[model samples]
Target: MKKALRWISKNLIKIYAFLGFTYLFIPIIYTFVFSFNKYVRSNLVWKSFTLENWKNPCKPIDICSALGNSIKIGLLATAGATLLGTLIAFALARYAFKGRGFVNTLIFLPMATPELVLGASLLTMFLNLGFNPGFWTIVIAHVMFCISFVVVTVKARIASLDPRLEQAAMDLYANEHETFRRVTLPLVAPGIAGGALLAFSLSFDDFIITNFNSGTTMTFPLYVYTHEKGGLPAQANVIGFSMFFLALLIVIAGQIVGRKRKVSA
Candidate 1:
C-alpha cells in the first residue's frame, strides 16, 4: 500500500499534464482529420476520406469570400494597432508629461472592458455618426481593442530595455533620431513583432465584436457560426488546418532565423 501510494503521488502530476494536453489537442486532431472528409452540407461523421476536400478547399464560394474578408481586416487592423500602440508604448515608457497617469489608465480600460460591451458601444457610436458598419467599421473596432493589447505587450518590452544603450549611442555623436533608429528600433523589434502577431490573431479570431460591427460582411468566424447549424463543411476544416500550419511554419522560420543570428553573433 505504501509503495502504491508513492507511485501514484509521483505520477499524478504527469497524469494530469497528459490529460490536459489531450483535452487541448483533441479538437485540433478532429479538425485535421475531418478536412479530408467526403461530404456535402454536413461533416458530422466520417464518410470516408479523400483528397478532393483538400484540392477543392474553396468549394463553397461564400467561404472563400469570408476568408478573404477576414484576412484583409486582420492585416489592416494589425498594422493600424501595431503602429499606434508602439507610439503609445514608447511615450508611456520613455516620457514624463502631463496627464501621463490618466493616459496610462485610459489605455487599459479597453482591455478590461468586455467584448460585447465594446462592440455594442462601437455599433451605437457608428449609428449616431451615420457611418455604416462595414469593412472600415470592423477594422476600426478591431484596432480599438487590439491597440490595448499591443500597448501592454510593447510597453513591457520597452520598460525592460536599458537606457544606457541609447546613452552610449549618443556619446558616439549619434543624434537622438539616429540613436532611436539604429539602436532602439532593433532592440525593440522582437516585441513589436510579437505584439503584431498577437493583434492579428485576436482580430482574426474575434467573433462577437466582428459580428456587431460587420454589417452585411461575412467573416470566417461568422460563416462558421452560421453554418455550424447546418453542419460545417470539410472545406472549413481545411481552412482551419491551413491557418494552423501557416502559423506553425512562420514560428519555425522565426526560430531558425534567430538561431542563425545568434550563432553568427
Candidate 2:
C-alpha cells in the first residue's frame, strides 16, 4: 500500500509539472495560431489559417521602421546604461565615502518610481527645459531606468568577488590598470553582460515611457498600442513569437558560451 501510494504521488507530481509547462506555453501556442488565422475579426469563430499579415505589403510599414528604431535605441541605451552603471557599481562596491547610503538610495529612486510617474516627470521636465521629446530624450529616459538594474547586478557580483585576486596580481608586478584589465574585468564580465542584456530588453519592451516621450517617434511597443484599438493583430502575434524565439536563442547561446569558458578554465 505504501509503494502504491508513493507511485500515485509520483504520477500526480508529473501531471502537475506537465500542467505548469502547458500553462506557461499556452499563450505562445495561441499567439502563433492567431497570427495565422484568416479571421481578422476578434469574433470567436474558428476558421482557416492565413499568412497574409507576413506577406502583405498593404499592411503598415510603421512596424518595420519601429523595429529599426527600437533596435537602435536598445543599442544606444544599453551602452549608455552599462557604462554608467559599471562606474557607479565600482564606486559603491570598492570605495567608502560620506553619504554613501543616501547616494545609493538616490540611485534607486528612479528605478523605484512607477513608469507612469517617471514618464510624466520626464515629460514635464523636457517641456520645462524647452527640449523636444525625441529619440535622444526617449533613450535618456530609458537609460535612467536601465542603469539602476546594471548597478544592482554588477554591485552584487563585485561584492561576492574576492579583492585579494587583484592584490595578488598587483604583487606579481602588474600595474593597477593591467591588473584590473586582466583580472577584475574578466571576472565581473558575465554580470555586466547579463545586466546589459536586461537593459536592452527593458528598452526594447518599454511602452508607457516611450509613448510619453516618443513625440514623433514610434517604437514597436508604441506602434502596437496605437494600433490595438482596431483589434488584436495577426502581425502582432507574429512579432511576439519571433521576439520570444530570438530572446530564447540568445539566452541559450550565452549559457553555452559561459559553459565553454568554464570548461576551458
Candidate 3:
C-alpha cells in the first residue's frame, strides 16, 4: 500500500500534465485535420481528405481580407505597445520619481479591468472625442490593453537584470547611452520580444474589444464569429492551421537562435 501510494504520488503530476496538454491541443488537432477536408459549404463534418483547402486558403469569402486586417492591427499594436511599455518599464525600474506608485497602480488597473467594461469605456471615450470607430480605433484599443501586459512583462525582466553589468560598463568609461545600448538593451531584448509576441497574439485574437471599437472593420476573429451562422468553410480551418504552424515555427526559430547564442557565448 505504501509503495502504491508512493508510485501514485510520483506519477500524478505527469498524468495531470498530460491531460492538461491533451485538452488544450484537442481543438487545434481537430482544426488541423479538418483543414484538409473537402466540404461543400461547411466544415462541420469531414467529408474526404483533400489538399484544395490548403492550396487555396483564400477560397472562402473575405477570409484573406479579414486575416490581413488582423495581421495589420496586431503588428501595429504590438509595435506601439512594446515601445511605450518598454519606456514605462525602464522608468519604473531604473529611476525613482514622484507619483511613481500612482502611475504603476494606474497601469495595473487596465490589466485588471474586464474586457467588456474596458471596451465599453473606450467606445464611450471615442464617441466623446468625436473619433470614429474603425481600424485605427481598434488599433488604439489594442495598444491600450497590450501596453499594460508589456509593461508588466518587461518590468519583471528589467528587475531580474543585475545592476553590476551597467556599473561595470560605466567603470570602463562607457557613457550612460553607450552602456544602455551595449549592455542594457541586449539583456532586455528577450523580454521585449516576448512582450511583443504576446501583444500581437492578444490583439489578433481579440474579439470582444475589437467588436466594440471596430465599426465596420472585419478582423479574423470577428469574421469567424460572424460567419459561423453559415458554418465556416474548410478554408477557415486551413487559415487557422496556417496561423498555428506559423506561430509554432516562430517559437521554434526563437529557441534555436537562443540556443545558438548560448553556445557562442
* Residue-wise C-alpha lDDT for candidate 3, range 124-211, written one tens digit per residue: 9999999899999999999999999999899999999999999999999999999999999999999999899999999999999999
Model 2 residue 195 CA deviation (Å) reads 0.7
What lDDT, from 0 to 1, does candidate 3 have?
0.93
Q: What C-alpha lDDT values do all the predictions have?
A: 0.93, 0.87, 0.93
Which order, best to worst by TM-score? 3, 1, 2
Which residue runs of candidate 2 sit more than 4 Å off their true CA positions? 1-22, 41-46, 56-58
> How many residue pairs clash in each candidate at the backbone level?
0, 0, 0
Return the clash pairs for model 2, or none: none
For each candidate, what TM-score against the reference? 0.92, 0.89, 0.94
Q: Report how far off residue 215 is in candidate 2 (Å).
A: 0.7
Error in Å for residue 42 of model 1: 1.6
RMSD of each: 2.3, 2.6, 2.0
Q: Candidate 2 deviates by what RMSD?
A: 2.6
Q: Clashes in candidate 2: how many? A: 0
Between which residue pairs do clashes occur in model 3? Answer: none
Ranked by lDDT, the better of candidates 1 and 2 is 1
